[model samples]
Target chain A: TQLLEQSPQFLSIQEGENLTVYCNSSSVFSSLQWYRQEPGEGPVLLVTVVTGGEVKKLKRLTFQFGDARKDSSLHITAAQPGDTGLYLCAGGPHKTGANSKLTFGKGITLSVRP
Target chain B: EAGVAQSPRYKIIEKRQSVAFWCNPISGHATLYWYQQILGQGPKLLIQFQNNGVVDDSQLPKDRFSAERLKGVDSTLKIQPAKLEDSAVYLCASNRLRDARSEYFGPGTRLTVL
Candidate 1:
């Protein structure tokens, strides 16, 4: 079973619309990260939330870490065609060393039409 | 700075054939990772390397898969007697350090085994 679960396996919307993708897990994590991958390319880091209850914004994209550190969410405002891609969530468990392994969610494919 | 570099952006092979993929991480990055991404799913970590030493490879199929990093720099992943189920995108990623929040990824090599 996947350690992290992402909802809305696929989403297609028109430009200027808003959307939210979620990542949920039963186990608490030390940190959570979100990435975006375009077709035929590798994923690109969008944001990382290390502390629970923390929220970060990157222009049109907003990321939040759950208070319990077991979940996270990504919200896109006024979506643009450029935002079209697959979104993935990854988490790191609490560990002593820096060499921690990451668990990934299945991901959500977002297609924004212009 | 250059992002992670991968070779042979695409490869097609028949079952039981062997193939290899190469990666060169960003300069000064000490942590390298190889991920396998099947269609409609997130990328899964296959192995991780710290410099030229292995740190994690629990998910790698040792019988048919082998990887090595030489001189703490470039790395290679090989699959022998490839299986049809092994068809996926082989992604190479790098981080400045193990604890670093973001990992830079290459375009990835798409492998199709028939």
Candidate 2:
């Protein structure tokens, strides 16, 4: 079974529209991170939330960690064509090391049309 | 201030052949990671390294896959007797030993096993 589940798998929205993607898990995590990947490129870090119930904003993107630390969400305000990419959520185990492994979700593909 | 570097952005080989990909993480970063990303899926951790010592490699397919991070800076991942199912993008990422929240990634090497 996947440690993390993301939905919807694919989404297409017009520019200026708003959308939210979710990542859920049955396991609690020490931290959660969001990444955005474009075609032919590796994923780039968008934000990291370590505290439960923490919310972080990066420009037009907002990320929230669930109170129980088992889920997270990414909300985009005023999506743009440049935001078209694969959105991935990765959860770090509750281990006590900087080298703890991260488990990733299947990812959500976002297509922002101009 | 350079990001992680990966070589031979693309590779194609027949099944049962061998292939290798290389990566150089950001300078001063002591933690390195290798991930495999299949089409339509998020990247999965294959191995992680702290300095020249391996911190975690539980998910690596030992019978067919092997990786080494020499001098704790550059790393190489190899697949022997590659199979068609091994076709995917191999990504390299790294971060500071003190900061696990900001991992930087390289432009992955896309491998196609025919």
Candidate 3:
């Protein structure tokens, strides 16, 4: 089974600090997506990277898909208390049909203290 | 446009009891998904539906877990004789048929099986 592994499962930093979270896997994916989930809510999509080595930016968050398509990363610039949440990375399979599914990482919990 | 909607924000029940959760996807979305997310983990897909037809349910525990999307709009998930490990946040998500890469998720239903 394909799996996505996230690093630094827990992180704490002061506001205005920069942090990077990594997601790695042995299997390649057609696309990768990043999501941020707050307490009492489901995850909200942050960005999606389809091509290898692709990068997408949304406000203070930047997401990068690895060149091999087997890994991805999310970097937060000048983190704020509002940005504290669980960050997740999900990978979509390359193939179509019933086997086509998305695999999610365990996620990294980030706490930005003001 | 309205996002996905789920009922019963929280439910607490003893083990072996039965429980059900309901979800209403955004209007006009053809694909809907149900996911189970244990604490400290990313959401795992339990089932997927495309216009009331089951697309994938490989991960769902067929013995005690069942879900259905009757009218291709709203769906229900039921767990009979739940176990303690069944406690988790149940999330519902949906996306258009043409764009499977991006998904919109609803605030999940939190279930606690004591």
**Root-mean-square deviation of each candidate, in angstroms?**
1.2, 1.4, 1.3
All candidates' chain B TM-scores are: 0.99, 0.97, 0.97
lDDT of candidate 2 over A50-85, digit per residue (tens): 999999999999999999999999999999999999
Candidate No. with top lDDT = 1
Q: Candidate 3: give the TM-score of chain A.
A: 0.96
The DockQ for candidate 2, computed on C-alphas, is: 0.70
Candidate 3 clash pair list: none
Order candidates by TM-score, high to low: 1, 3, 2
DockQ, all models: 0.82, 0.70, 0.65
**DockQ (model 3, Cα):** 0.65
Docking class of 1: high
Which ten contiguous residues of candidate 3 chain B have the minimum total lDDT?
A: B95-104
Query: lDDT score, residue A105, model 3?
Result: 96
Clashing pairs in model 2?
Answer: none
Task: Name the runs in model 1 displaced over 4 angstroms.
Answer: none
Q: Which lDDT tens digits does candidate 3 get at residues B25-110?
A: 99999999999999999989999998999988989999999999999999999999899999999999998873478678999999
User: What's the alpha carbon RMSD for model 3?
Assistant: 1.3
